[model samples]
Target: MAVQTYSGSCHCGNVRFEADIDLAEGSGKCNCSICSKTRNWSVSVKPEGFRLLSDEQATTDYQFNTQSVHWPFCRTCGVRAYGHGDIPEVGGKFVSISVACLDDVTPEQKAALAVRYADGGNNNWWNEPSDAEKQYL
Candidate 1:
């Protein structure tokens, strides 16, 4: 798939960034507490594929629980721009960018992309290999 460029920013326009990602692989929605509360529909990409065009000082970090993930939000607008997940097995990092913040992407194009639902809230159930596991694991 061709690499596509996407531009996005915070609601108050204090933070802005661009990313080169594969839209064909599409996006995902995690049923975890934070994600569910924020309604954050996102897509994961390698750390190197994303670029922050503005001042990094304008961003604030929010972390909870195990704190393995870093949630970066705009300080001025309180909008989550992206998040980082550690993946030691792959020797890489997973970055989840908010799809709602992405600009210039047509609604049709967004709808056409595949949406994978992750059962993060019921993470332990993923090991059971049941029908629900097959649906969102």
Candidate 2:
């Protein structure tokens, strides 16, 4: 897949970031409580591939479950542009960038994305999002 740089930020622009992403690789949406409530649409980018352009102090953290993921929201705008967490498989941390926050992608680009809905609401992250994939197809 080809690579592209995406710049995004919170609704109020208090929290911002840039990431190198391949939109063809698709993105993720979870049925988890917070996600379901916020309708978060996201793509994963490695630490090196992601850059935060805003002050860390501009955001506030909210966590649940095992507290592995830190859901940061811009205090001023109440928008969660991204989330941070460590992955056991990668032996490192990762950033989940909100696709809706992206400033440059066109609506067509967004519509073309293949999204997988994880059953995170049930803690069944191990299983493939089969039903959701089928629906998209």
Candidate 3:
């Protein structure tokens, strides 16, 4: 209900992390090429609120577009559970956490979450997704 630490990991459990996330603050879906392809529904948190709990060496970073964000995934399982970036739009350092990767979330808790939509595919990072896109996202 409030900001609390949540455990998350990549599919193979090779990359693990903990983040202080407040679901009431909301989560989001981005209609960008990468996000759309991966279906990366996420929550944004300050970098200080995220901590890597496993081997960093077990993961690899993938960057594209302006190359401002580091999308890290488990090398073994290829699941991108979280990423970090320093972007002005988010007040400097931020960690983008994959909601699907969270370990202990309940169906009720997930249903209670507010969902924000972004039209990232058109380079509109903070705008709403198109109606047609919304249905799928």
Candidate 4:
């Protein structure tokens, strides 16, 4: 996959960023509670390729449950821009970008991307496949 430049920002435009990422594929959508509620569709990216163009203070963090991840949103408009996953040994890591936050990318561009379904709410996501699971998984 070739590397391509993509730009995105939070709702109020306080947090803007540009990423040189391999957009050859779409990312997975999790059926977890938080994801379902927000309808968070995303794509994967290497931690290094993703950059923070604005000051970190421009966003506020929202965490819950085990508190393993940080969902950073624009403090002004309350739009979730990105997130950090807590992996053991690696600590917190940025693994994906919210598709809704990205710009100039169309649904067709996203359709060509790969999709993975995460069982975040249920730890045993690997074991079960519900009827609706066929679409994204």
Candidate 5:
């Protein structure tokens, strides 16, 4: 599938970004604590594939588990607009951009891409859950 550029922002528009993604490739939904709680619908891209247009101070970071991921949320509205993490298999770093925040995509448009559900809750039914993190699109 061809890569396309898309724009997005936080609920209060405090955090904004642009991402180059191939929507046909789909995104991810994990039943992990943070994911399920936040209703995150996200897709991954390399650092270069994403650009944060807002001031870095507009967002706050929250992390758990192995603390490998830096989940960023809008300080004003508490919206988790995006996240950064590492996937050694693909690259040294990656960004998990929220499909829900895509300005041009409707719920249907976002849903059009096949979503792969990870059993994060079950896979992480322990203190250490890194071994269960997903490694896919």
Candidate 6:
């Protein structure tokens, strides 16, 4: 799919954002602790493709392990709307938009998109894990 702008928000609607994403580029799931726990399904986009449509102070950030990624969520609803980090593999600064939080994307559209799995639990960002490992991720 071509790049398109998507609007999204947290459960309480206190945190809202917009991002331009191309689902054909694929979304990702990671076995990293936070991702696994949150069941984060996301797509990456350059910082320019993302916009915070609400007050930045309405969100809170959480960082762990390497503390490289900043996961921001709505303070009122505790829904992780998106995350930001510097990943050389993805150019430089990038935003990881939560696919599930997208308000305009239908379930059918999300199901049809390609998904990639990462073995972030083991710190292997560049390698795809075994099929068996992917099952649980």
What TM-score does each of the candidates earn? 0.85, 0.88, 0.95, 0.82, 0.83, 0.93
- The stretch of ten residues in a row with the least summed lDDT in candidate 6 is 128-137
The residue pairs that clash in candidate 2, if any, are none
What range of 10 consecutive residues in model 1 has the weakest lDDT sum?
125-134
Could you give the candidate ranking by TM-score, starting with the highest?
3, 6, 2, 1, 5, 4
Question: Which parts of model 4 have CA positions greater than 4 angstroms off?
Answer: 89-92, 127-129, 133-137
lDDT of each: 0.81, 0.85, 0.90, 0.76, 0.82, 0.89
After the best TM-score superposition of candidate 5, give how far the Cα of residue 85 lies from its true spot, in angstroms.
Answer: 0.7
What would the per-residue lDDT of candidate 4 be over residues 1-137, giving only the tens digit for each residue? Answer: 78888898988889988777777655767777778678788876767878889999999888888888788889899888788785654344655678888987778887787766677557655544365864653
Q: What's the TM for model 3?
A: 0.95
Q: Tell me how far the alpha carbon of residue 27 in candidate 1 is from the true structure, in angstroms, after superposition.
A: 0.5
Q: Write the per-residue lDDT of candidate 6 for residues 49-130, one digit (tens) a residue.
A: 9999999999888998778899988889999989999967668899998898999998999999888998888889777878
lDDT of 2 by residue, 46-129 (tens): 888899999999999999978988998999999999998997864578889999999998999999998877777777765555
Could you tell me the lDDT of residue 8 within candidate 1?
87
Runs of candidate 6 exceeding 4 Å displacement = none
Residue pairs of candidate 4 with colliding backbone atoms = 25-113, 26-113, 26-114, 28-116
Candidate 5 pairs with clashing backbones: none
Task: Kindly report the root-mean-square deviation of model 3 from the true structure over all alpha carbons.
Answer: 1.0
Candidate 2: clashing residue pairs, number: 0
TM-score of 5: 0.83
Best first by lDDT, ranked: 3, 6, 2, 5, 1, 4
Colliding residue pairs in candidate 6 = none
Model 1 has a clash total of: 0
- Model 4 local distance difference test score: 0.76
For every candidate structure, what is the RMSD over all alpha carbons to the true structure, in angstroms? 3.5, 2.8, 1.0, 2.8, 5.4, 1.3
